[model samples]
Target chain A: MTDDATRGPDPAAMLAVAEEQQARALRLLEPDGAVIYGAWGVAWLVGPGLMWLSRAHDVLPIGVAGAVFAALLLGAGAVTAVHVGRRTQGVQGVSQQTGALHGWSWFLGFATLTAIMAATARAGASDDLLALLWTALSCLVVGVLYMAAGALWRDLVQYSIGVWILVIGAAGALAGVPTNQLLMSLAGGGVFLGAAALSRLRRRA
Target chain B: MTSGPTLNGLDPVIHAESRLRITATLAAVDRGDRLSFPRLQKLLDMTAGNLSTHLRRLEDAGYVEVTKTFEGRTPATYLALTDPGRVAFATYTAALRALLRPTDGGSA
Candidate 1:
């Protein structure tokens, strides 16, 4: 093989190419932020919005509202799975493993938390108390998970969303029942939608 | 006086412009992660023939691994940097930095 002395390309030009290619690679690796954030935003808004509407007005039955909320959450989960899977398709290695493990963590975390909450309800927790507990704890889990993801990826937008969710969750708990639902539907959902827009703008920039 | 190996230390295998760009792109991926041939070509904006030629050179030097497989009914080609490739690229960058470093300790 020839040495660098025999090669004619300037070192500075090569360095520039390296930097440019690296940036391109990273961009290709990043999942579509707008889709992810938007899916959650829609779910957060409509799900809790329905719940609050049922509570405030006698429009839909609470049972139906609850069912819709659960369904929306499931839909959001499915979207996240599909989006991530498609993006990483044909790629293998530590990144794929990391994504798989992280996805399982969310599933396991919610399943365990739900089981514990259900147990509390069975043990004579009042319906109102159960509702507040579920809301607070659910938000707490999402907040913590988002923050953990942000830290792992070093994404400021995700970290900020986590902080906002935690704050909203706390405020909603203190506000109580119907008000809490409204707060979550408005404040919680609002932040998610706002973040989605911001993410899109940042991508464009 | 100069202390160690200078610009002469740069790996000729990776020193070429196209090969350097290819190596840099592959290096950005997570260890062991691979990029599809079409994807890498698009990223580099190189013609398939051009990319294949450079890739062969890198593969020859044991710096790259190219895998051919079937994705459903379609043929697919994926490429990744071998461990030795990573080391070579790292060493190349270090030597490049050394060469670029101002001899009087000024900013490069």
Candidate 2:
């Protein structure tokens, strides 16, 4: 045993060092994070937003328009996924593995969206509990898939946000919340932009 | 001119093509920013030796730091910007912006 007078490593200093390292890691992680979310914002969320507007304008048959929108959305998601995957391919050992996971999840998400649109179309605006449950489950499935992918990417905040999308979708379906889309826009798109702003500020400071 | 900051306080010599692109790429990242050598190579399309020379200059200037560790028996090189480097880049950018478009009271 050491004497009481002897000095040991300072816990506070250790914590500070860890914090600094974390900050550094965050700095390094920023680029990939921005690209991922930026692509997600433009491709995934924007497609839905555009479809909503088109439907509002009665530009085409609702079902037909939704199908076209789903195709477009899927196309966009595929492009981004493929790009990220191509960029990070063949990197042996690094967090770059997250890129592959993200790409696959994006493709999976696109497939899920297609399914949701099909199911909803078949249900024909019904207020049935079964329809709501199925939709909610679909949302949950997609959200969990995205969460897993984001976790692999080491984007914890984004992963949590993605998982929460399921919660919001399910809650909206169950509670018959009409503003579900708006809420998601705020949660998914708004939160992402906010996080980006905060990150930029931190870097500048 | 008017004593404003540059983007990264990077000297013009440092701000040459490759380094400038690298700094801009790094600056645009959110958080947890790391660039692998291969990624950097792809991004800039520079030969390994050319990239290494520029990286060395950057490291010597205290702008970037490199880490080399084994990745399952294969070695990987990671590049990160130091805090000072970030500040300098941001300052340099601000200066460039000020020069390019001076802020006025919404002047037409």
Candidate 3:
């Protein structure tokens, strides 16, 4: 065998080809930015709704109820997000890892919004007109929330319809309306029931 | 024809063992959310340095990305799979599935 010094030098072209392969291999994976995006959206929807509830209860002595409700709902959201993150810790794929985050964001956002509106109503806002207006807006916004979540999860359920009722009820309440609870009830109740419907469908399938 | 190892989309040597484990772990949790470093290390049953080295390799490959932020005074490490990593893992799984499927002759 020839000595190391006598061996022909490694081909320059071969080294270039190997380097190119390494670079190409490294180019394939990009971190899933969607996870962060979903988390931010969830935070935004809940945070604003919580703050609004605190403001709506201006008549209340210390806004204790509103603040408590905000803490609970937001706390729940944060817990859920952390739980999901832990669960998917080493998982691959954007779609698979984001499933829980998407679900958590949708439900928490809706619940927080609903609770805020309810707190506003109970705060002794004597102006039925303003109460109605705020409630209607909450319904519409909740509907949009449901719609967003539904699209992500890909199943149409009663929860989506509930959003519509919340919107309509708020409108009626604003227009000197009386006894328009059905809309609000449907929207609020729809969330739990909608989740159930999806579960049932999955089981049957 | 005998099928062999491939990289990305091209035939190449199989990935290192540590990297392979990281990929499998991530793939299993794809339907969930992010994973913390401590949890990942525990699940992989690896030393902190070992797992960190493996993670660095995967991150260099662009299959995973790490986010470091402070939770109060403590630092937190969160990991998530990138879109390309997901696709690569899926393809790898499909190939494995195909290989594992029973053939017409009743031997895999």
- Pick by DockQ: which candidate is best? 1
Clash pairs, candidate 1, are none
Give the distance in Å from residue B99's predicted Cα in candidate 1 to where it truly belongs.
8.6
Root-mean-square deviation per candidate: 4.9, 14.9, 13.3
**Which regions of candidate 3 are displaced past 4 Å?**
A1-126, A152-178, A193-205, B1-21, B27-36, B42-50, B53-84, B105-108
Give the TM-score, chain B only, in order for the candidates: 0.88, 0.75, 0.73
Model 1 scores a TM of 0.77
Give lDDT tens digits, candidate 3, residues A59-142. Answer: 333346436545755665576567556544444345553564767667676667668767766876655544455556655665
The better-scoring model by TM-score among 1 and 3 is 1
Q: Which pairs of residues collide in candidate 3?
A: A30-B82, A89-B35, A90-B26, A91-B26, A92-B26, A96-B30, A97-B30, A132-A173, A132-A174, A136-A170
After TM-score superposition, the amount by which residue A2's alpha carbon in candidate 3 deviates from its true location, in angstroms, is 40
- Candidate 2 chain B minimal-lDDT segment of 10 residues: B1-10
Displacement of the residue A189 alpha carbon in candidate 1, Å: 1.9
User: Interface RMSDs of all predictions?
Assistant: 4.1, 18.4, 14.3
**Per-residue error at A105 for model 1, in Å?**
0.9
Instruction: Judging by lDDT against the true structure, name the best candidate.
Output: 1
- Give per-residue CA lDDT, model 3, range B40-95, as digits (tens): 77666678887787677667767887888776899988776677677666665455
Instruction: Put the candidates in lDDT order, highest first.
Output: 1, 2, 3
